[model samples]
Target: MTNDPLSPQSNDSQKRLMVALALSFAATAAYTFFFAPKPQPPGAEGADAGVVLAQGADAGTAEVAVPPPGNGGTAESTLTAEAPPPPLRKVDVARQEAKYTFSSEGAGLTFAELQGRKMREQQTLTIREGFDKLFGKPVPTAPQMNLAHPVPGQPLPLSISIEGNTPLPATTRYAVEEGTTPKGAGTLSFTGRQGPWEVTKSFLWPHEGFELVYTVTVRNTSAQPQSGELRVHYSRAIDPEFEHAPSFFGGVGNLSRSACWIDDKLHKLSPGDKPPEDTRGQVSFFGIDQQYFLSALYPLDGPMAGHCVLTATPTAREVAAGFPLNVGPGQTATFRFGGYLGPKDPDLLRTVPGVALRDAAGLSTAAAFHPKLEDTVDFGIWAVICKMLLAVMKFFHGLVGNWGVAIILLTVLVKLVLLPLTYRSMVSMEQVKKLQPRLEEIKKKFADDRERQNLETMKLYQEAKVNPLGGCLPMLIQMPVWIALFTSLRNSFDIYGEPFFGPVWTDLTYKDPTYILPLALGVSMIITQKMQPQMMDAQQAKMMTWVLPVIFTFTLLQYPAGLSLYIFTNNVLSIAQQYGLRKWLARKGGNPTGDGTAAVSAAGGKRK
Candidate 1:
């Protein structure tokens, strides 16, 4: 409530700091409000960065610039005779948006309904096409894909195959041979070849913690068996342009290209395996933001399939394939395999035999390092300590339903938990503040010799029992928790669109359009910094006093509003903690002035 600590500046340089901070805020507000370009309106003509030419009043075709009758130009040719208006091509924007589901069902598979959810930018698997087909020509270009959400008890559309390179003879009739050994793993036998040609396949969803294994047996109908290539191709029609690369089904980074998953590698699969053909089989996985997906995509094969893990951007490297199999007539060659279709759940993936590749989960893919070793000498130690601290915070979060409240409670709990340590630091800071006049005197007395002044400063620190680093240690220790929590909140899907006190902070991953939270955060930051006793040179402190808050304000402007709220709450709470500590120290001879602003107790005194 005191304005002295809340003022732009205090005993030290005040006017310069206030002016600089005001200018900075003004410039930032101007840039953010007036100077920055606004987002283009949806469906506006030429709004696709000038890609779209024009818009019509009706839903009819709008004339776009095209080349002359002979020339291949995208520009209107004034020299060419005016051609009759091109036939109107009605473009149904709404229909196109509703038309396609981005995933296709595998051949012979019956998909009742397919629902699609985005996990991250790269890996999105939707059930696109599902239908029955006589596989004589592999159903030509394949059936149209479907995107309707699956409903239980509904019969799945069947993908049937009647024609193939090796098909049943015209005289042959097929009889069903069902197997009961494995659940949903069935076999149907056809009378052909020499005896029964057994077709082994399953349509039902695999049982939990179970794998599907199929064994196909073909016998020689004629006395003399024929030998031919049993070309078995696993054909699944995916959105060719879905991710650009079929191998890397998940794209790279936040703005990744389309991806393809071939073998184990994720790549961009365009139309041509070589060149010229630009039709990419992969669709862009650039916008699907799911934490489980982002963390699971890397080290894909693991025990954590179906679990909520972050998906990683798959690399462009090629994946290795297992050795091919040889199937002989009369002697059935069995090929056993399995796959995962949904999210990566470790428990589910680990239980399935021969499919342990799905358990890959957690956040170890991001490289851990600092730009400068000297600047982050003890970061590793700090990270571990911070993780432990966050664990404590998480423990509290588990008790509370609201993350915002959890953060506030966490801050309070931390402040209360570290009261003694902070008190000690403040006591030292108070000692330094009290001796400031003496220190300045010493500086004046030894003005000509810098080394002597430093010696005297060290002596003061030794005499007052103040560790220069004491005030900073607690703050430094909390940094890892801050960073980790920021990361968690930003990436956690739970906080998406999660509201906290009106629209001021609804989404933790995006900024508030109104910017009320950032402004509040900035104000609180300024106040908190003011309450702390100044330790640096007057000019430096004045510069930093305002500069830091401005920097933080700008940084928070575009960050998750939840983070800004946390910081604002932390600052406000710190003020109360400082005030209380100052009062307590004053009573104990730590501060003689009783007021936190004035020099008092040495218990949490400044570092020499």
Candidate 2:
């Protein structure tokens, strides 16, 4: 309404409103896209993985069965002569819900499928125990988990389920598959009976960073050609709330809008394209306390036809498993699918028949290559330069056996390489500070006119040969380097458990719970900020002198300890460099007063 077209207060208010609207829209879109309604499948129905009790409930009753020697029996027998102890048993009861339990065949072997739960698909009849055969040799261990949430002091539940609508059989043991073929040793013993059709299966830990693979060969024992629907059902120990979370399956999976190595030259399937009639087999994914998405390549004509169904919600029941396949009389159709129940590992991903896994932690493969094309002006050239730096870091790490030290050495190397630019920046800053008195006089003469203040400042900058942004250039150059280092630390599995100088710091990719590094980082930052050139305003000074160090300290508390240590060391070194620069500046006729005089005002000749 007034003659003023650009009042400060009105402009600021308008900016705030625009920002709020933009944020609200972004949040709404994110919710609609990422958290939209996608119900769970029916096959996902189940209670928690129930607990299994030790042998017997009573004391001294002994939970396992002890067998006596068959022919040669005596107390003088060697201890090794005694067979390994039987596998531990776990069972739990769910109120008003179906019951499930799992047990193993023997020590270091997978649990067998006891009564209940059998799939209709033909599979090798190995005991449904938890185990893996590496190099064709049985691994005497259990499946390794990235993180364990076993309820302390409470029994762990064993999950059990059946698929393929296989009819329950009366009490009988069937040898559908054998591990050591021709009857050498290992075998799967499927004991079947009726009544809710429960089957107990055991599991063994997998090798570190690898997933446990359970493959069983089943003979279509039914005389009738049974074919209709196939079910793949499971129950886990996770809660219903986390059952549909992508993280429950494997966080940071390789999901892409395009493929890198696939045969994409030919007319490929679009996101909405459906294949030929013969190629449209159904894939139903169901899980309890587990979230999953599926992509499959079926033998179409010769090569393969791809079909996929992504799990959208935690409550969507029973995604249709397409139509059923016909099982010929006495003939078996081998169905191949796998479950990845661990963190995303590049090497282990090869075992899965699909795309690589990526984390939803914001960094995408395309984003990693963004600066090369999108930010051509600022980062395009720098990306190429950083590649050489990355090679150097890798080379140093290869020699030192520690990434933390390598980062420090790399930082030092960069500082050395850019010493000339930094020295110039420091010299310019010192000169600018020395001329603060003169600059303030100019500001006071033109205080009422904003345009004149900027012109006078520019004129002074020209005379002094000081580009006000010179200092910013060095900082700008360091950003790409810092980003590259961050990426390296984030993705390097070698640093997962690698020790740096001892237990004081282990696993450079995770936070140091003790807060030692974060505090040290805060202190170092404070020191460096104090030594740097004083800001042009009290607000700016307060931010650099107090607010930033406190914020970074609190921030570092939650970041990886390795990253904190790197930042802390960097700040300490910066403080030392700044101290040296200050001493030199003082000797070179620079102003002794640290309260940047250029920030003063002409009102009563006051210094601000």
Candidate 3:
């Protein structure tokens, strides 16, 4: 009889093919949904704004008046309403590490771009122009004093009213003054004044550092005493460009943190928490931080009496801190402040001077400081492991002078350290493979009884002195290290623009632009699996051989190149070790198979 093409058997085969195709598509969609880089929801991009907290009666003494709901008004709108834009004059300062641009209008910093950075497209760190702009209004360009409470019916402190009434100009055209400091460091000064008050803003740019010492001097020119709170603002809007990038993890978008060091501890406020009403004490530092950059304000001389107010919207985060200021008539009050606007490099942050300060009476004291400023790195629960990995990588880089080579070396070292466990696992797997024939016979003998088959399988494993789970234990043990390494490579700023080989692997902190590394990694994994001794049932082994490689390849496609490089190197090392171990065992004539005769002979030899 001739089989017909349209027979039920043919139809069944076609249906099976369609189902398989549908499953493949579903799996692809599932992978994309779980592992693909997802665009953040509106207002959710920069959520982990660093620790924001406040203490002290002065913290929330003056409440910012917000217009009632349905007014279509925001704090920015309410504050800037009817305010004229100040005529802005540009000021540029260039150093070896960074370039700074300032506008005379509010003496607000317009931009700070780091030099020698690989990804320079959006490297400018300053998100906004002025400190007062944090509050949604145009305050004087220079940092100035704000009244604790404005007089009833009077304009808010540091508002347009202050600029309109006081002889102090809302916008002063600061004369550019240059001088060489005693240390031969270059100094840039912008000096200006409003009615009866002379304000001079000076910056001491070192020949070799990212930290800039900024000093603001306010002189009471009038015959009466002037008392108010001095305020410095650090505000940044989330970078829209990095919102979709893989490096934009943790605190991307509206996830920013505003934190202050109070009473020797770091106080962080959540997004929904109200800004502390009164934060009073030795405030060592307060700033706004994003994923890769930090903009912080520090008191140069000592812990100043200060409090911070942190506010955020869907697109921006603003931190405003106030320091007590009292300038006697005809007396000048010069306050020194330090500003850090750069990458969140732990080493760089450590190099920042004035982390410790001297108090009055010449006693040295620890300031309100977070230890190491390392909190900015956000290494998560495995932070300790991550730091260790980074240290090792850095050490390797120092020796090899190439990040890609260093990563390979790091992988080798990790593998060597875990060699014993992996060796044992390989032996166990080989034993399981040797027992596969016997296991298949037992399965067939008890084909109708799954419980009896499992019992007999366990008894067989016991008799052979082989652990069925030994192979899995080593992998489980190494899981944390693998996870830590992945996190470290992904979040490391040092690797952001670091090149592995040449232009092709230009940025290890980002995904491979050419997809070569991930594909190679996937291929290496397949080879490693094939080389390893397998003990799975035929169907299980077949499924793993095909599915695992594809799944890993797609999953790793979105990971940073550095991570992919590590995995690829590790797989290669594992394959080499497995091959070497197998050859060594064969030469030794040890039974790699758990056959009953080999087991009996080994036991008898041991007894002899």
Candidate 4:
């Protein structure tokens, strides 16, 4: 018998097998990485927050009758009970990074303007307009928590209510008192009394933080005990104009969500077609959110059992949380809650105490510092990888000082780490390509002997030191990094409204209005694919060469410019590496032909 071509003593064969096994592991990892479903746009399924409750009959059961405001009016004036509107008072609060406008109409925020942030066109990024201008008319205006009862028989439940024997008039105007907190923070007080019960709402805006503390105290001023529920209502229009708007990454409506943290996990509420139903649960935090910002209510002490109600009109959607209060004859019940109305920056959110929790039974012992708050950023299935990538990018950004430059540096760092494996993979694929002719010859020789054909094929591969899977393995190994980078850059709060490369590539978080980045990325992909050695049949290779670039180009058209920029930079680097590696192999006297013996002979020629 011919000496065994792949004897056990062959160290080269062992090394090749080890490389093959490593590459196989990478392929398996890539398969698992991509197996997750593509992320759906937030709120894509419907405008209604997912939890639907029966409102009409249920809400009526909990409704209480009270007199309208102004001079003595009876609770029985239901037919003509139009209480006079409360006088409007505006309170402006400013911190270093943002300014907020609050209206006393419902003791709710009216608008917030981020201090130095500007859109691509240099317009202010103001959250003032409740809804986008639709049709020919301007957007309708309303208070966030209007203290009005829903039309009788209406399906949506009322978010604001005074729940016991003593009910505050719907038109009661609160006496305003403004002051400073102990920490030199601005404070606003709204106090009002109805019958024997007195209510006071206080807001403390920190001197330099993203959240505010709101406290409501109810006291029994009379001889008898009193009990009532004070519902702090919140509502906003799910403006379709914001949906898929070009100003933000992932588009406007794509990131809007209404959800609550129940039992330590997030339950996303669906926006429904009908009026909102009420859901009761042990809630830690509840609210509605946009891509970069959120407006949520968090209980400071711990989780509290409360009612979460969702209401909607043709043009708007509302969500609110109800907190119960009961006071004895002389006791006061003060319910303290925290309000988060700012950017969903991971660093900032982490600073919010208890947002992350520790759990020992899981793969990771580290608990999320702010519980489910960081989930506002919406990193998809590969969250661990995404977070790590973000940390790396931030490190590079600190060094470079420019977000765009930092991203490019991050791409280079990733490529350098993978260089050694990539080199081996490319060489293995090149060797495989050279053996295609010999493989075809063996097939012809063993036309009728299938088993012999298989054995001969294995022998040929062993002798040639080739790993059949090497051609695609390196690409597979890089997929998780690619996905992670995509997710991190797309959701990065730092990149929002940040400009790069002048007007052509203004905001990294927004799509390239000129469509240049995506187009360039598609071309670069084609060039990179062409540079790689082909291991597949001619037809399949041809199809991939043309099809992949087209598919990627269209898919990336709507993605954030920062993500496209990373991909394009990576492709260019890959092309450069492949070209350099090909030359290195040639200089080493590596075989360009199928025969391994020929390469050995060439290398030995100079020595002889």
Candidate 5:
């Protein structure tokens, strides 16, 4: 009944108490050893909370690395995909002329949908629409061209990365900050961090034009130095629906290529062309160059030393340009770029982002960089003539407010410039018509002497005060104009989406969807050929009058409608001019000095 029943004996109680004390002491020692040290606020010594640190490269740049989580084991710097990424999204920054779409995953451009009356995609016509187009009804239009469409698995356009190092994955989720630019334009700033590296992309929409301004900053927060190629990428998944490779019978379709301006020279590569071994130089611009549209990047600091990497496949076109950089601990490197995503208009391309953009970007305007961005609209060998044609057409367009009328006026202006030469050519043909009988007689007399026949022909030509080659002067002069006009239509943005009288000629730079214009052109060409004096034999004349027209129609079926319009207008004008000249001569002195009908009557009257 005493406490001995509930409690142990004194010696036993002492032994049990000692054991209990030992166990309690052990538990206390373990808790103190494990919980005494606090985990520092990231980046301190002996911390274990799984915090990441990163080093980011630039657009088409070099390398980046992410330090390991937890301090116990110092793993090599690398990017790991084992962990789940944050939610991805898209952000749109719009202006008066365009809407730029960006992806939060890569903090790069997803696609840019341009907005402008003339910037819409080429119109597609149905039978009813075609009828309406033919009947002078209003033609319908398609949506605007959306450029920089990324391939499913490829890097987004304008994405930044290091050639060798990056902290966050290119597809890292970012925190976005939206604000207004100094010019009152909308701006989007994206920031992503991993390990000790952080990257930020700040994009500002321009008040007008297709040129956009963006700034990229890469920071290293680690206590160590970081170096890598900082690259900015521009890639496009060329939609076969929007692009067409140039065929023998096709106009210069949307032939997309990769282009770069380096060290004062421009280099372009098509899908199958071999790339150069070295792309390093003072790069001014680099991007994808479609015949009518351009998507490129020019440095806000003008031309800077960098290397360009180009990739062209049947389905994609890509360019990445960047330079090497070494960032010290707690320091940052910034890159500013001018993004051009619009028609390849020289006027627009010529004006790079200037002080306004710099000031809006929170950068100094002193010594602002100016790049020769207009060089992207290259007309190659026809540059001079093409520019002249474009200038004239633009002037006429401004005055007339219609591109079709401007083209006709341009043709008239061109014809007037060469009127003297064409008039002389017609006169030479008339004079040669007068000598045709003598030429035939000489040919008969020297049937066996080919050299003698040629001599007599030359003698007759001399007596008539006409060079035998004079009749070819008009053709010689017009050949360059024709080729230059074609090149202009293919390369110049002035006539890109301009339409003629109606839907039959929706896009002047594109082929006439209907065969009406080209076929009518063929008929007019036949009449013009017949109107010219018979300079060749019966076989050659027949071929020129009929077969030539057929071949020409087929060839032009795939050419720009604007070129055909010019030629058709020229032919009609020539006919009127020749008829007027013949009538004037008949009225002046009743002399048969006319060029077309009179010459034909006087020379080939015996055909019957």
Candidate 6:
């Protein structure tokens, strides 16, 4: 009313309401014309299965046209705002050891099946086959290992996603191009676009290795600028029924895990464990670590600041490497990545791209490649010892060409290294035997004074120039070597699937299917214990001799065959060494070798 009355202090309320209605109507009309759902054309109707560009994004930049894939690549239909699917297609690229299948839906790895002898799985032996193998019958090898077995649904390995102001889902499809690369390598390029960005994933798979060079390029297609984090995702589906979590006290667990090397350290998450909270740092590599085998991706240009998100469940393991980017109109940001999908072999993993790899993946001279992929093989707390033992075993293996023989040779090497210590310990034990009579008298003398008994025992030990605890030193020294060997068997791929004289001792990394090795180990352990001087009270001696052997056997029964084999071999050698030591002692006017209890009986007679 005031506006109608001009310059007065009032306006017309009805006029204002009409103006609001008109503005609302115009917005509704615009939305209907641009975004309202349209009817399906012909037979273009079905389940909304295939990936599509997110709604409300610019339709002009929705589809990146692709030429007909002439060089064995598939011709993919364009993804539209109204049209749902373009029919999923696939392409396969085979290297020497692994064959990778990429899906056009996500332009990512569907399955990475590893080939070769050692990579072959271990078959379940029947009772009849077990007996035949125990008697030295050869068994057929198991099937090849599939790095992407039980494939995860959607957002497959090496998929791309853009998160920020204009987000792009990983489900978006890409037009793929497949061709042969230089140096007999296989190549595959995936190109797609949504909203303001166009993305391309280029891969170079060498002819004969587990390495792959990958490059990701994202370009701003819209007139306006775009900014976000480019995420590269890797996922694997594991059936909990078949997979088990790793346990040091228990046997070797074969469950695959997710790992990321952020900053200076490596972070791993096994199935059903909590994910790392702080993962922002300079990332070196990340992927699914399946113990003996690995499928990982690392920045080809070296470590760079990035955010890595890790996830694990009873059924799946996932890792996403996110790199921040800001692209001006028409500008492109490209990121290079190096990938490894093969055995966690230190020789191969530790080696960067060399001259042989220069022409393999069209890599930038292969000199800029420095990915610390070897860390995937976690050596636990005994890394130093593990490395030393593994080095010696490798040297011996090179000489003998047999892993079992190498382990035996390693045992001998360790024994020889500690020869001086063992000799000193043996002499000390013999001297303690001479003082046993005096020790019993002292125990009876100070029967009620426990503190006085201890002081007198120490004084007697010092006077005799002997150490009563000397017998335990050799065993203590060898404990580290044993643990390192166990760690190698659990992780080091060099001995992961190797055979030990064939048959029941098929795989050293795996537990012995037959209980023969562990049982033999227990027998050898008992004989060795009986040969050593019993330094403890009657009850403790019984526990050490009987209870310890039974428990040790039961424990080794579930451990890797390599460990039990090492102990059994060491015990046999120890028995031989002790026999020789006793003969030497007899010659020196000490305990004789004939009566196993000669020294003990003589001491008892003297004490009486």
Best by lDDT: 6
- Tens-place lDDT per residue, model 2, 1-608, is 45464988778888999999999999999999999987657534233422223343332322221123342422232111212223344323111112223333211112212121111111111222212221233423312221222222212212122235553221212212223223222222332222222232222112222222233223333334545433232221222332221122122211211111112221112122342111232222221111111112211112222322222222222111222445544445443323333322334434432222112112245432110111111223345554565578669889997878877887788777877787777766766665667677877889999898988788766655556666666777777776655444444434444556653454565455456678888988788777667625568778878898897687556555566766777777677777787788678556344433333322214322
Tens-digit lDDT string for candidate 4 (431-504)? 76776677677778999999999898877676555777776776797789877876676676776667667534
Return the TM-score for each candidate structure: 0.48, 0.50, 0.67, 0.69, 0.81, 0.80
User: After TM-score superposition, what is the CA distance of residue 122 in candidate 4 from its true location, in Å?
Assistant: 12
Q: Model 6 over residues 447-528: C-alpha lDDT tens digits?
A: 9999999898877666555678899899999988888899889888888778888567678887777778899999999998
- lDDT over C-alpha atoms for residue 221 of model 4: 58
- Candidates' lDDT values, in order? 0.41, 0.41, 0.63, 0.63, 0.75, 0.78
Best by TM-score: 5
Q: Candidate 2, which ten residues in sequence have the lowest lDDT sum?
A: 369-378
lDDT of 1 by residue, 1-608 (tens): 34586555553457778888999999999999988988867644342244343344442443332222223322322211222222322111112112211111211222211123322222222212111121122222313323222222221111112223344322222233333333332223222221223333332223232222222334332222334332221122234333343122122112222222322223432233332112222211111112222111111122111111112233211111112223343345433223333323333433333221212111132321111101111124345554454466557668876667766787777667777787777876766676677677778899999999999888766655567777776677566656756665543444444456642343444455466778888888788778877776788777767998897688666556667777778788888888888788767766433543342234224432
TM-score of 1: 0.48
Q: Rank by TM-score, highest first.
A: 5, 6, 4, 3, 2, 1
Number of colliding residue pairs in each model: 101, 55, 37, 20, 30, 4
Best first by lDDT, ranked: 6, 5, 4, 3, 1, 2
Candidate 3 Cα deviation (angstroms), residue 140: 39
Evaluate residue 279 in candidate 5 and report its C-alpha lDDT on the 0 to 100 scale: 85
* Ten contiguous residues minimizing lDDT sum, candidate 5: 54-63
Query: What is the C-alpha lDDT profile of model 5 across 350-408, one tens digit per residue?
Result: 65664455556565656666677788777889999888888888899999998889989
Error of 4 at 397 (Å): 0.8
